[model samples]
Target: MPELPDVEQFRTFFHAHATGRTVRSVEADPTIVRNTDPAALDRALRGRRFEDPDRHGKWLIGWTDGPALLLHFGMTGDLVWSGEDPHRHRHDRLILAFEDGNELRYRNMRKLGGVWLAHDREEVAQVIGALGPDALSIGRSEFGERLARRRGGVKAALMDQTFVAGVGNILADEILWQARLHPRRRIETLDEAERATLYTVVRRVLREAVRSYDYVGRKRSWLTHVRGIPGGTCPRCGTSLQRATAAGRTTYFCPRCQAADPAVGSGP
Candidate 1:
């Protein structure tokens, strides 16, 4: 699934190609248009000039002078730009034609995600109201406060969208591994210093992931490189990594590095 970093990349790409450009036309697969029909989507965005785009969690908001276009990339959705006569992929569910003859396509292979139309800012807020603060925008003090409030395992707290938005299974695992906290360790058990380390590591890991464009571009030293494979070893130490279910998702961590004991907190 596309997380915060992946959505940030999509937001950047959307802004670069569509900002200040008027929508000349729209073609969409009705099945992929959520909350509104295909004709309604066209009517809302047909001639509106796109302003700077914004992203909240895994959701992408295309701001315009009128209605806003909201997108959730679900598991396999992507936003791609194409030339005037660009070959259309079969999975291209949504297409927006700019006055310059260029096209922006929302391609989804699995069709799990869809698009939404918001006529007003309040409508936009209604869509994302359930989500907590954007993970990247949380300050140190706020992150510490949020972390301190959670009674569940630290990994579960991190993965909960209502606790802190944008973090998914992959990011939760990466953050815990980097912070050297066991996935099942209770948040309250963390000392002040440990909490501070977690706050710092969360922002650092997220910022680095955003700059890398996506998780696949993460460095070899990152646990992501080996976490998915069987018998994978920790990059920090040569110790064999362990795998188990945490927060209802498959999780990976170096047992030697991130022992279950709360006192054990040492990481690169």
Candidate 2:
């Protein structure tokens, strides 16, 4: 799953390559773009100029003349840039040919990715209404206040989009491991120091992720390095990493570093 880091990387790429360009053409193959009708998408975007691109959580928003295009990269979706022919990838569901002869394509191997045309920019607010403050943008005080109110496990609270936007399975696990907090620890149980640590870890992890290219899992030093490596050792503690499902997604944690808290073991 593309987390906050990956989404931010894509946003930067889009802003550099596609923003402020006039759309010469729009193409969509129904088999690939699952959520959007081909004809309607084409009618809404063709010949319009791309205003700017923005991101919230994992959602990518590209503004046009009237409607805004929303892209949700379910699991395996990505954007590619090429000055040559654009139809090189069979998975390319949405293609925008610019007047400058450059092309930007959205490719998704899994059909789970969605493309929605929002008639108004405010529609984006409705689509991601559950999202809390952006992980990168939230202040330490605000994060602490939000964390103090939650009763769920620490991992669940971080993973909840409503609690903090842009934190996915990988980030949640990495942040918890870095903060030395067990995944199942109750949010209210965290002291002021622990809450501050959590906020710092979240910002640090996201900063490192954004610096990496495309937020792809290509770097060995990244948190993605420990995410699903079966029997992988902890990067900091040198102990074996453990895996389990928390909040319905696969989670990784350093058992030695973040021991299970008895007090919060039964939390939501």
Candidate 3:
């Protein structure tokens, strides 16, 4: 699924190309639009100019002169910009044609996540009300407090959107690995110091991801460089990375680096 950083990039993309541009036409797939149908979306968005967009967690909110557009790029979804004679892929769920003849396409293959049209601010709140504080902006104290409330594995707690929005499987593993904490480590078992360390690590990792457009494979030191490859070794140590089901998602970590006991830890 698209996490916070990815969605942030999408927000930047949308703001650069679509903002302030009038929508010349609207083409939407009904099945890929939530909260409203295709005809309604067209009626609401046509002739409106897109304003600056905001991102909360993995959701993108696009404010127009009229209605609001909400987008969630599930597991395999992305926003694409095309020029003249664009080859419209079959998976292009939503297409917004601009007055300048440019196009912004919301493409998704699996169709797990979709677009939503909100007529008012109340409707927008209703859609995103369930999400917790965005991971990027949550305070350290609040972050620790929320994690302390989770009685499950630390990895699972991080992956729970209700606990702290925008973290998914890949980010959870990366954060935990960097913090030198095991994926199976119980949240309740972490001391204040450990929790503080975790808070710092989360902020650092997330910010690094947001700053770098090509973060995942750009650095050899990042675990994401070899997350799921065959015989992938730890970036810190030479130990072969291990994989298991944590938080119901495939997790990868270095056994030697991320010890269950903090006392035996490699410094984060």
Candidate 4:
């Protein structure tokens, strides 16, 4: 799934290419846009002009004259921009041709991504109502408060969109590992110092992610170096990195660094 940083990059791209451009045409292949009815989409967007694009959590909103078009890129979905041919890929769920000859395409391999037109602000609010404060926008005090209130594992809490929007499995593991907080530690067990450390770590990780374009720690960097290596030894401690399941998602953490509260450790 495209997380906050990836979506942010997409927003930048959309803002530059599609905003203020008149829609020349709207094309959709029913097989690719499984979540929306094609006729309704064409009727709503074909002749309208695309305004600014906005993002909340993992959802991308493209504003038109009336309603906003919402995009959720489910695992393998992405947007492409080209100046040449407008139509090429079978996976292109939605295509918008511009008057300037440039085109923006929404493509998805798995077809799990979705699109919806929100006729009013209330509809947009309802779609993202469950999301907590955006991880990047929330303050330290508010983040601490939310962290202190949850009793689940810190990793699971971070992964929960209702707890902190925009954090996914990879980010949850990276942030917890950087803070040296075990993934299985109960949230309420965190002291003031731990909470502060987690908050700082989250900010640092998110900033690094934004700067690097979602490729954080994917290279030789400390966090990225460890995360991409399966069955690899911990970078800080030599103990073998552990893999387990939490909240129905695969999680990775260093046992020596983020080992569970010695008093409450257990296998998944």
Q: Give the higher-TM-score candidate: 1 or 3.
A: 3
Give the C-alpha miss distance for residue 119 in model 2, angstroms.
1.9
For TM-score, candidate 2 versus 4, the one ahead is 4
Q: Rank the candidates by TM-score, best first.
A: 3, 1, 4, 2
Per-residue CA lDDT of model 3 for 63-157, tens digit only, reads 99898999999998899899633789999999999989999999999999899998878899898778889999999889977776779799988
How well is each residue in 68-112 modelled by candidate 2, as lDDT tens digits? Answer: 888888788888998544455988888888888889988888878
> For model 4, how does the per-residue alpha-carbon lDDT over 151-224 read when each residue is reduced to its tens digit?
87778899898998888888888888888888877887887788899999999888788788547555454555
Q: Which residue pairs of candidate 1 clash? A: none
| C-alpha RMSD (angstroms) for model 2 | 3.6
Which of candidates 1 and 4 reaches a greater TM-score? 1
Check candidate 4 and list the clashing pairs.
217-224
Which parts of model 4 have CA positions greater than 4 angstroms off? 31-36, 84-87, 214-219, 262-268
Give the runs in model 3 whose Cα sits over 4 Å from its true position.
263-268
Q: Single out the weakest 10-residue window by summed lDDT for candidate 3.
A: 259-268
Please report how far candidate 3 places residue 24 from its true position, in Å.
1.8
TM-score winner among the candidates?
Answer: 3
Ranking by lDDT: 3, 1, 4, 2
Per-residue C-alpha lDDT of model 1 across residues 74-158, encoded as one tens digit per residue: 8898888895338889999999999999999999999787999999999999987788788998998888777777797888889
- lDDT to native, each model: 0.88, 0.79, 0.90, 0.79
